[model samples]
Target: MDAGTRNRLRARLVSLRDELLTQGSMNIPPARTDVVSTPDDDEAPLTHMTQAIASNRNRERADRLEQIRDALALVDEDPEQFGLCEVCEEPIKPRRLELMPWVVLCVACQEKHEHEHRSPGSRKHLGDFQ
Candidate 1:
């Protein structure tokens, strides 16, 4: 890619990474509250469960933010590697790069990777799932 295009992609990736970080940091731990009713109360249990679920989701978001940061770092370190498939070492399509500047796989290699590594019991029947 040209220098201008690479610069644009880098800027985009950096902005995305910053946004993810900001959003992830905002997902703080759920506050604990005193239960006024019996422990067996439906609302209390449901509220606690919902808070737990939100905590888990926040953790996952933090992990994803880290991944995005790493991807941005890679792009900064080597622009040439930005649009190349990590699995097949092929040039990723420009449109794909435009859509996801930090992607590390070409379309074909991404498809293969998804098919081969998808979780067990996951449906893989469609060709366009990816």
Candidate 2:
């Protein structure tokens, strides 16, 4: 890739990393409350559960942000590696790169990775990253 393209992609990845960090703010523990017979009191448990779920989502987003940071490091070390498939060593499609600048695999390789490695009844494979 040219210098301009590398710079643009690097800028974009940095922007995304910042945006994700801002969005994935640490979930605050629910505040303690006094005994009260109100709708808010009745919904406290559900609210806490929602907060827990949001916290988990935020943690997942944080992990992706780490991946983006790693990709940025790789970009700095070798801009020529950008947009090239790690598995096939071919140029990844422009649209795919546009959509996911941190991607390290082409669509074909990604699909294959998912099919071969992803478990049917398990959480996402955090290792087979983009």
Candidate 3:
């Protein structure tokens, strides 16, 4: 990638990192201290479900933040390889980077990774045989 594009991407990554941190801080649900265990508590299940969902959201957010940080570090450590895919060592499309600056794989490699990591119970389609 050219200097201008690399600079632009770095700026974008910084902006995105800042935005994610802000969102993470703002989205944290306050700690609940009013819940008491009761044999007939009807809302217990709902409360547990809500906590699980929020925990997942926080985990996802943290993972994305880590990716962005890694991308920024790579940009600084090795500019020549910044836009290259980690799995295939091919240059990722500029459009893809524009949309997701933190991505480390090209679209094809990403698809393969997802396919390989899919749950065992997932339906096998025609493409799975490939």
Q: Which parts of model 3 have CA positions greater than 4 angstroms off?
A: 25-32, 35-40, 121-130
Quote the lDDT for 91 in model 1.
82
For residues 1-111, write the lDDT of model 2, one tens digit per residue. 678877888899999998997765766566355556344777878878878887888787877888799889989897788778999999888777777898899888888
lDDT by residue for model 3 over 29-62, one digit each (tens)? Answer: 4345557745336766676677778888888888
Model 1: lDDT equals: 0.72
lDDT to native, each model? 0.72, 0.80, 0.84
Which regions in candidate 1 have their CA more than 4 angstroms from the true location?
26-32, 35-40, 124-130
Query: How many clashes (backbone N, Cα, C below 3 Å) per candidate?
Result: 0, 0, 0
Better of 1 and 3 by TM-score: 3
Q: How much RMSD separates candidate 2 from the native structure?
A: 5.0
- Model 3 clash pairs are none
